[model samples]
Target: MADGTTDQGPVTMLATPISLDFEFTPGVAQSKFLRGLERGEFLGQRCGTCGQVYVPSRGTCPTDGVATTEDVVLGNSGTVTTYCVVNVPFAGQAIEIPYICAQILLDGANLSFMGLLQEIPTDQIRMGMRVEAVWVDEAELIPSLASVKYFRPNGEPDADYDTYKEYL
Candidate 1:
């Protein structure tokens, strides 16, 4: 008891698990986006003023502060604008360490959204890397982003810096 050192080298504490439930209302624009996901469609809303598109839109444009009513169907493919390798492990994480989490700029959309990148080595991940969504089985899909499992390389040429510089 007098000595500061102990036989145990380190101590690891597991987090206490808990459950929470709540009901959420996906407003007009968001509802539309979710419905699109249910049907295997990648949908975004364009600002009536700036023409900027947003996925899973918040019902209004951040820049123009105007309602985004126009439904724009976007493709599953996109470019990686920026990313980080998840080297640290955490409690309840299902993915293995050293995964790539990148901000993908989907085709024809002005804004970028975060997505998991896989199928390519982490060492080879870089900005402007072309990628495509890996969707779940048709029957398993639902009105959620989870429909898209993850993204993988599409074997396409990298996008030029000029194309995604502003987003970075």
Candidate 2:
């Protein structure tokens, strides 16, 4: 037995352990995309039936319900379909708070990827704003989306809301 101020058994407290060793084996589609990233290219797979393009490539097309094999290079520039200001900090977020995160539909690609918006104020970020990828330094190329530093405004006029509204 133990008094109120002392413990007779092991004392336990709630704690979460954090670590950084993360590794994975890529599937067929992801393996191809990773190879492309190593070569400094963006790879996409086109749906055989619907002809829709999926960037970062997929093993199968969701629309046509079939495997896609046609690999294409998505353009570096795209239009921001929608966005949000991430004022709240989150785990594993590389950038600071009050940054704009956006969904961009690259030219000639049907699917869009969510990425961080940079080189502009969060207040200036709007739907349909033209943007382009900012590649990471040449020495830092890797098999991941992190290869692209971020997307920034390209000084082009904003697109019509209706033009990309459905993408949202």
Candidate 3:
């Protein structure tokens, strides 16, 4: 038997840093979504079986667990189903604190996605508010949602809660 002691023998410890370099394909649905973003478009996928549409398309029907095949183009304007006022700061966040992160239900789509809300007073922001995508210049368009700088009030009336209650 060995007693619990650190004086038994000399021990050596080594530490090292490692970096990762990898590449992958975004798959069929994601690739189509990214391609649409590059052209300043919103492409959603439709579940063949359930007929549910997903924005930034998940490539599958979450409810039915079936692969989405049909591609649907969505409108830039949408309704804010819900939102939060960000009062705390976190690492790697580019915008100033006290901003609104809203879940928007784009027109013609069945799902809602989160995006930064801008050009609107935080105190005035509310659920069911109408907003539209503010896109960057064509020259700056990339294969990413970054092309859509942010969503802002579209000068439309706020929708009733009942209109978007399912998303919330």
Q: Write the per-residue lDDT of candidate 2 for residues 1-168, one digit (tens) a residue.
A: 556756445768767887799888879888888877766777888998999888867689987789998888878888999889989988788788899989999888888889889999988888899999888887898888878889999998998878777688
Worst 10 residues of 3 by lDDT: 8-17
Evaluate model 3: give its TM-score.
Answer: 0.84
**Looking at candidate 1, what is the lDDT of residue 113?**
92
TM-score of each: 0.88, 0.83, 0.84
Candidate 1: pairs in clash: none
Estimate the lDDT of model 2.
0.85
Kindly list the per-residue Cα lDDT of model 1 for residues 1-168, writing each as its tens digit: 547767765668877789899999988988888889888888999999998889868889999888888999998899999999999999879999899999999998888999999999999999999999998999998999999899999999999999999899
Q: What is the C-alpha lDDT profile of model 3 across 1-67, one tens digit per residue?
A: 4677656665576556677999978888988998999999999998998887898886888899988
The segments of candidate 3 whose C-alpha lies over 4 angstroms from its true place after superposition are 1-21
- TM-score, structure 2 vs. true: 0.83
Q: How much is the lDDT of residue 85 in candidate 3? A: 97
Instruction: After the best TM-score superposition of candidate 3, give how far the Cα of residue 56 lies from its true spot, in angstroms.
Output: 1.4
**What clash count goes with each model?**
0, 0, 0
User: Over 4 Å off in model 2, which ranges?
Assistant: 1-14, 18-23, 91-93
- For model 3 the local lDDT of residue 35 reads 91
Clash-forming residue pairs, model 3: none
Error of 3 at 43 (Å): 0.4
